[model samples]
Target: MRPGATRVGIIDYGMGNLYSVAKAVEHLGASAVVSDRAEVLAGTDRIIFPGVGAFGDCMAALEARELTDFVRVAAQTRPFLGICLGMQLLMESSEEHGAHAGLGLLPGRVLAFPPGAMRDRDGRPLKVPHMGWNELHQLVAHPLFAGIPQDAHFYFVHSFYVEPANPELLAAFADYGFPFCAAVAVDNLFALQCHPEKSGEAGLRLLGNFLAWDGGGGPACGI
Candidate 1:
């Protein structure tokens, strides 16, 4: 963390790969600190929530850390990014295991891919975790996609996906079985179902864009 560099707080609720996410922020010339303290997050210029694994487990961890309210408030007050399971935790609930409540920052549900809809072209099973790289189709313009080209490949590793209640909140979609919300952006919050840090050049560009974001919505934030 250099002097005058933007400080980006990466929430460590015992779920995310905080070190990798921290490295990504630092690679972009920003200060990335991994902590679960509300006070630390409050002082950050921006915050990122990156998680791996189950929806229920992630939410439970946040609840244990008493970060449910803190996250919701920080997201609205500054530039916020959610990655993978972190994005799904923004939904109202998850159907992964019975009915589990999330942060409810976004009005939607995290649903598993329908059993019958998990096949790729040529009628082959695409696997439950939809692993590897997939192309992202931009549905709307935002600062996050400024330098990134259209239909760029992003690394993904998830079984569940977000179904945002408001269609306008959708920023991009990708095909695992059919089109699913691969990324979402609205106001000061931005979330990605894919792992941008693992997505190579295009992914780094998106991170750089997020680092430069001024918390004023999209392109106007930087692009």
Candidate 2:
């Protein structure tokens, strides 16, 4: 690691797209230290909690690794970014497979896209998992959206979406059939339902903005 380099801890609870997230962080000129060890992660300047797979399984993995509490504390105290399933885990609970408690870092619940409620512009049914790229509408002027277009397309692949208890917590929204929470920003914490690593330039710009952010919910300092 170079001197003065920003060390970003990519929390590895064994259910995340660790390699992709690490590569994205390193591509932005930051040192990515992927670890589950609280001691090692605590030493980093920022945290990227990335995850894939079911909500319950991911939470169970965090618990199994004894990193649940560590994650809760780390997110509140630093520049934390949660991606996909990682974002869902920050909620109070989820109804993915069954009722399951979450990290409670944020007040919300992850709910599935109602099976027959979604319809396309043509009145055709939209599929679950909400796969493929979708346009993200910025609801709030957040630092994380720096340089990203107001309706930029980002890669999304999920069956459930977050519903924050406080409407003020919503940073962005996207439509599969109807508008859904795409991102949330509160203080030092920022999370996204879309995969930045797979979203190309706009995605990278978002990640870069995150790296330059000072956890103040203001404009990034510039990478």
lDDT of each structure?
A: 0.88, 0.90
The C-alpha stretches of model 2 lying farther than 4 A from their native spots are: 218-223
Query: Least lDDT summed over 10 consecutive residues: which range in candidate 1?
Result: 214-223
Write the residue-wise lDDT of candidate 2 on 178-216 in tens digits. 889999888888899999999999999999998898898
lDDT, candidate 2, equals: 0.90
Candidate 1 overall lDDT versus native: 0.88
Structural similarity to truth (TM-score) of each candidate: 0.96, 0.96
> Over the stretch 4-46, how does candidate 1's per-residue lDDT look in tens digits?
9999989999989888889989988899878988888888899
Per-residue lDDT, model 2, residue 222, is 22
Candidate 2 has what TM-score? 0.96
TM-score attained by model 1: 0.96
Q: Which residue pairs in candidate 1 have backbone atoms (N, alpha carbon, C) closer than 3 angstroms, thus clashing?
A: none
* Candidate 1: segments with Cα more than 4 A from true spot: 219-223
